[model samples]
Target: MASSPTIRYGALAQTFHWLTAVLVVTAFILGPEGSEDEVFRGADLGRQAHETLGLAVFVLTAARLLWRLADRRPDPPDVARWMDIASKAVQGALYLLLCAVPLSAVIGTWLEGHPVTLLAGIEVAPMIAASHSLGERVSELHGLLGDTLIWIAGLHAAAALFHHYFLKDTVLVTMLPRWLKK
Candidate 1:
């Protein structure tokens, strides 16, 4: 099998990175607003889409992690020690949030005695016993985590841009697909 370029991620890694970003933003936009009852009731396309996208993010993250274990990543551009530490911290937080956001949603929905509704008439029934109050709290936590994820991701993008424009480094370019790298 061919290996990735020493200075750039392979196409698969680039694809996963960009696709995850799109899915996260789209899911955030589609998230239903209102009380738990209002969100769970009726046939809401937005809610269904949000749940589906969240699930997709969770699955994609798992796959990306697995791929990373075997894939050789591009070497990091030369930078200050602090910058490297901050970058790793942000990346770790993003991964944690990616997993937590979806899990909280599932746990919250299940605890509230509701099924996780998805597109194409699919539904995942609650596996845990009902605890309406705790469910509400967990659902609220999910919202907070979602917001945090967006903010951290924004910071990550800004850092990449800074490296690209100010530092004149390959930090961002290393992840760009062939078409975008030109």
Candidate 2:
């Protein structure tokens, strides 16, 4: 399929982009937050849903990365040299975290000897024997990573808006929905 030659992303690339964004944001929102005391809130179902969402995000992101490698999408906008470098760096970090966050949670959950069930109730067995202390530590790291993803995502969106409104560039336009395009 031919992609837009100028600033528009191809349909497949745009689909992957938006799907990943929505899943990542949803996983962040559904995942546990704040103190350990308030983490699960004694809600087993909520925790299960959170775990399932994280796993789904990991799977989707893996496919997205593969798609990205194969797709001929629009190139980066003509921004300043420094901005280009910074943008690439941020994008790289976001992709890294997209994989890392969910994998960490899975490992942590497995190590804790907790059952990881999918949305359909398929059980994922533990990789290690029950070790509450270690699992707790890993869980802390998982929470930290999730929080960092949220912060970075905020910065990313803000930067896109800045580019579109202030710099008057194609950076944001390329990724916007067709109905929202100016």
Candidate 3:
């Protein structure tokens, strides 16, 4: 069978893949703890950082989406039928949640009249009124999306491990860093 041309996923894809991966993990893990709850009320700075990173992930995901559209990526191996289907489904859901989580935050922030901070370490200017119901709802949705994201990411990671150990294919390597392949 003819094989596809292989190279590191275009630079943009690699950047989006790794950077977004780290940011997603960061935002999902640290976001909840930084919520406006009693426990972290004293650590408002941390909370702010969490919010900033959360917003950053959202924006980066958007950029990644745009980049994805510009570059068409190849599918997984034809031999791994089940893995291909499963990964695609999980990845689709992940993409959905990726957008949903940030959307919820945008809605919540707008409701709360909070400025969307992009981590310039500056003050956030609120666009809507503070203490609004919409903000609360969006915040709740954000939490739910975060939970979903965690599951999808875990499954994705596990699948990569499985691919390496069991499938013995280069599926995972397709996205690996350049140095690792050498």
lDDT of 3 by residue, 64-140 (tens): 88888888675556565776678779989988888888778767766766555544445567666677666777777
TM-score of every model?
Answer: 0.96, 0.87, 0.80
**What would the C-alpha RMSD of candidate 1 be, to one decimal place?**
2.2
Clashing pairs in 1: none
Lowest summed lDDT window (length 10), candidate 1: 173-182
Report residue 22 deviation for candidate 3 (angstroms).
Answer: 1.1
User: What order do you get sorting by lDDT, best first?
Assistant: 1, 2, 3
Q: Candidate 2: deviation at residue 107, Å?
A: 0.6
The candidate scoring highest on TM-score is 1
Question: In candidate 1, what are the lDDT values of residues 100-129, reduced to their tens digit?
Answer: 999999999999999999987599999999
Residue 39 C-alpha lDDT in model 3: 23
Query: Clash pairs of candidate 2?
Result: none
Name model 3 segments beyond 4 Å from true. 1-4, 32-43, 112-121, 128-131
TM-score between model 1 and native: 0.96
Q: What is candidate 3's CA lDDT for residue 126?
A: 69
Clashes of each: 0, 0, 2
Which residue window of length 10 is worst by lDDT in model 2?
35-44
Candidate 1: list runs displaced more than 4 Å.
1-5
lDDT of each: 0.93, 0.80, 0.72
1 or 2: which has the higher TM-score? 1
